[model samples]
Target: MSMFGAVDLSSFAPKQGSTPAEPAAGAAHNGRPGGLVVDVDAQNLREIAEGSARVPVVVVMHSSRAQASVDLVDLLERLVVEYAGSFQLARVDVDAAPEVAQALQVTAVPTVVALIAGQPVPMFQGSAPEEQLRALLDQLLEVAARNGVDGRLDLDAAAHMAEPTEPEETEVERQAREAIERGDWTAAEKVYEHAIAQSPADDDLKAARDQIRMLARMDGQDPVALLAAADAPGADLDTQLAGADAALAQGDVNACLGRALEAVRAHTGEERERARLRLLELFTIIGTTAPEVARARRQLATILY
Candidate 1:
């Protein structure tokens, strides 16, 4: 079933074999204050569209005359900075680039579109709540990754975020990291498990243990297909649990917890207990300090009582 509801967008795909335009001279790849935000016009539309071949480009079609559009663009600019080059933001002033807007069949201001591999995907129109937009972006990344558009923008070259000093890994953590690099997931999981068992009160070790377990479960698996299977009518508990793992595998912690939470909400007796335990596993994966984990914990507490 198409999510866009009869709005055919296939025509928006870039023409086949159209050579991608090169970046301008002296471009520092997000050399502006708005991070990866770039102004798009008739002249640059092809450039921006073609650039999607490398990384997903989020096109924000807006009008300067509208305060809502202005506010949305500002919010998107901040979001681009926060995302650390997950995607490039192409700001198209519909007034200035009327031809571009008309070509894309935009009837309103503040239309948001995602271009992945030169295929235009309709996202939303008008402004959205920050949390909602964040969720959408996560979903977008997951979809893009499944379609083999897993390229990431060079965050090191981004101007928005300041570089941070990386902490030296402890010996045990280093061993576990090496094991993971070697595809010895079981060994990596065991290393963390042994460390956590020795230092029962060490929260960091416990978190690392959970992370290792998550990576082990997600190894070389299609998390998207797992999610789709779980969403199938009358899906079993095992499939639902696997879907939760898939969500975490793709970096959507909310969806990971959400799948288990939904199972808990829909089941009772032994099934609900299993679902509850699964949610607890995800909580451990993210840790208590994570905002999403905290919120999910609250939701879980509310559901239980």
Candidate 2:
């Protein structure tokens, strides 16, 4: 089952071959001080959710027909400005993106949900006092930190000034960048993997490989399906491994490592050794410096001796 529940959001995905409706004039801030607010629809919902991999995105679903919902939107906008880009606010007009709202199972107007690493964490429905909302937001930030989603948008830039362009890239870097842009994660990974193999000592290549691996893991499979398969009674080691990868992809580092550790404790002899090796491989993917990796290492040691 999904951490969020039995909701299958794939059904709500924008239909293929249909053009995405453009945002209304003034609905999006091109570049403003604390540019953390954006109007979202079914077409852009996936992109906004994916952005949670970098920073927590608070999605507010509301209907323009309701005055209360409009008031809630105004309040959220003010809060986003006050928060100074600590988190982004994605406003979803229910009338415009009913599919998106239905996917989230919104029973009423002005439902708030937080997306952390592409997974939804339901916040609340309807409006609350500013003080209570701030407390809830504070808690959300804490959750974001624990999941390694602690990133902030640049809030100090002036809206009137033109945004700076990125520097040009090398041939290989350009290839990888384009592949990533096109959502060809495997192709991008191959590029980085080959570069790392050619120059094993290049820390930059190694870092790039790790980052792509994480992205590939996230984009590789559906977390809910993987979890269900792993939970099956007759699930083999391979199934368990895939589930662990899915968890890691969803930014549940602890769940990923904990599942592997459970395997280590459950199996023995050759099977145990295989689990141990797989856990070590995951450690490398997560990086040696991560607190989750460190904690898993200690747990592994305890399980061994």
| Candidate 2: segments with Cα more than 4 A from true spot | 1-157, 161-170, 177-187, 210-220
Quality of model 1 by C-alpha lDDT: 0.73
The 0-to-1 C-alpha lDDT of every candidate, in the order given, reads 0.73, 0.72
TM-score of model 1 relative to the true fold? 0.48
**Which pairs clash in model 2?**
none
Candidate number with greatest TM-score: 1
lDDT of 1 by residue, 152-191 (tens): 5665555545434579878998999899899998898899
Candidate 2 per-residue lDDT over residues 1-305, each given as its tens digit: 11232334343233456333332333233222224777787787877776665667888887543445778789988998888777888888764566687777765666888887677787877667788888888988887777666767666542433544667787779999999999998899899888888888887677666667656655646777988898899888878877787666544557888889988888899999988987887777666665667899999999999
Error of 2 at 223 (Å): 1.2
Tell me how candidate 2 scores on lDDT. Answer: 0.72
Q: TM per model?
A: 0.48, 0.46
